[model samples]
Target: MTAVIEVQNLTKRYKDKHALDNVSLSIEGNAIYGLLGRNGAGKTTLMSILTAQNFESAGTVKVFGEHPYENSHVLSRICFVRESQKYPDDATPRHAFKAASLFFKNWDQEFAEQLINDFQLPMKQTIKKLSRGQLSAVGVIIGLASRAEITFFDEPYLGLDAVARQIFYDRLLDDYAEFPRTIILSSHLIDEVSNLIEHVIVIDNGEILMNEDTDAVRDRAVTVVGDKAKVDAWVADREVLHREALGRVVSVTVLGALSDDERAEVTASGLDLAPVSLQQLIVRLTQKAGAETSSDNQEVR
Candidate 1:
């Protein structure tokens, strides 16, 4: 897989706060990537820099082996669907699609029309008068139908209901199958998009917390449920991410993969081992990172 986006020691500072802190990572082409983190975690900042919408305070960023700023060639191949995408006060969905068609060389007018119909969007209504869900539909339609070589969706479907969001996800996957491209999706609905993403990149406190294959991330933790005494003995030397207890029964989530023999032993000991979902794993990892950061700050003081 070729790298379509690259960053080296990237840093974006705003006054006294760092939006991005010495972040370094490469995004491969022709795959779906989840750019995930809590609010203020630099997900949007990183995407802004990559799409040339904002400047990085320090370090380097490259898209398609060249700087993205003022580079029409690089910019043309990228589509950025912001969460609060704006349009002219008088512009309607029709005008919005028209402008997008002219900008994105790979834009599919037929596909755009189909999406409009799917969402039942009113074409002539001014964008300002449109409902929140309708406004979001416009962005989703543009993002999907543009078909740019590399697309970034920064929570553009937040206003849509569950069913509508599902439609966007389905259409995205369908189009991507026929025309493969690099898609970086930054969203708070981690569990919703977990299966859709091929890779995961997690940021926390302006730093990269986790970057790896989604499958590998899933294997990073496991939960065991059994008697308190048995669970405590089994997890005594392991790193525990989360734990819960109810009347003598204990459930402990630990970091590390158990070998086949160990898994067998666990079952033989009457403990139930459960696989961790991507969302669960990411939440635990971020919480752990936050706890450690607080501890370190206290030590520094």
Candidate 2:
């Protein structure tokens, strides 16, 4: 499949700091992408640049095969749903949807209305008067109902409760199945969005750390459970990402997929392999960022 979004050597500098350092990533069509990173890691910066909402210090970005900045042809095919979306002080959810209906070619008024009812959003209330969760709901509805070919949702569930978040995820998947467009979701709630994402893009300190199919990433690490001594012995000399112990039992997640022989050996040793959690995998990848930087410093010296 052709890439719908292509970013090459994208760099965004803020005075002395580099917000995005030579970042390059391509996202394919009809895939749900999870853009994940710790705070200040440039996930938002990259999204802004891709959507033409922010300028890049140096690099190229192509959305739908055209530059997005000031280019209506490319811009019209995309929707950016931000947590803190700006609205005219007196604008209400009804007004927001009305504007979206005019902008997005594939806008579905019926879908928007359904979302409003499901989210219990007050359409008549001024946007400024709406609570944080309500404000988020407005953005979520616009994003889902717009049916843009490529939609970027930047943490659109900030103040929503667990139930509301679930509703958003379910509705997003339902709508996506019917529409079949590329959806790039930037979220911190990894476990919640894990099942929805087809691919995972991890950023650390303004650079791409890991970009792979979610299933492939899961296979990169295997969690072993058994007696503490047996699990520890199995993990020895392997790159252990996470370790947890419960009484005499221990669970250790180590990098690398085991071969048939290795798997048989592990079971023979009385240790069982468990599925690695997406959250755990991401945590280990991002947490090692500091160690990676430190090693770079040493090499530079």
Candidate 3:
């Protein structure tokens, strides 16, 4: 399978700040990729560059095997649904859908209509008058119905409630199953979308931290749950990513996959091994880096 998106030595600078630092990555066709990072970690910047909505200071970007900048052939095959998607003040959901239908090569009118009804989006109401959830719904509708070869959704569920958010996820997964396409989602709600994403790309500060299969990333750490004393003993000398305690019960997430000897030791220790959540793993990794940076700054001071 050919790569749908590729970035080589991509760099974006604002004044003296580097939003992206020599970031190089390739997204294969028909995969759901989760762009994970803390705020100001360059998630939006990278997405904007990939979609040709913003220019990069240095590096190369190829979408659909060609440069995306002003290239109608490549541009038309990609859809970027973001929280700040703009719309004409007077336009309604109906108008936005119409415009998207015209622009996207694989626009599905029937699918769009179905989504509108499912989301209960009022077509007659002007987009400016719609609630925040409604605005997000419009974006989700277009993203799914457009069926673009490579779709980017940057925090597209801003004000949606739990029910509405679930609807969006369900619909996205369903559509993706039938019409497979590369979907890159940047979101802060990690736990919610953990299962939906097969691949995870993590960014920190201004650089790529980790890019691996979701399962592999999860396997990078394991959680041990048992008596607090036993858990601590097992975790000592191991790189602990995170730890939680509830009275006598304790859980510790340790980095590095368990070796055969280690596994036997864990089993012998009367401790149960629990699967670590993707969100927890990412949170710990980024938070650890943040803490280290803070400590270094303090030392400098």
Best by TM-score: 1
Per-residue alpha-carbon lDDT of candidate 1 for residues 10-52, written as tens digits (9 for 90 to 100): 9999999999999999999999999999998999999999999
List all candidate RMSDs to the true structure.
0.9, 1.9, 2.1
Q: What lDDT score goes with residue 159 in model 3?
A: 80
Candidate 3 lDDT score at position 157: 83
How well does model 2 score by local distance difference test? 0.91
Q: Give the TM-score of candidate 3.
A: 0.92
Which is the winner by TM-score between candidate 1 and candidate 2? Answer: 1
The alpha-carbon deviation from the true structure for residue 200 of candidate 1, after best TM-score superposition, in angstroms, is 0.5
Better of 2 and 3 by TM-score: 2
Scored by lDDT, the top model is 1
Stretch of 10 with least lDDT, candidate 2: 283-292
Score every model by TM-score: 0.98, 0.94, 0.92
lDDT of 3 by residue, 10-124 (tens): 9999999999999999999999999998889999999988888999999999888888889999888999999888898899998998999999989999999888888899999
Model 1 TM-score is: 0.98
Q: Pick the winner on lDDT between candidates 1 and 2.
A: 1
Ranking of predictions according to TM-score: 1, 2, 3
lDDT (Cα, tens digit) per residue for candidate 2, span 153-260: 999887899899999999999998988999999987889899999999999899998999998887888889999988887788999877888899998888898999
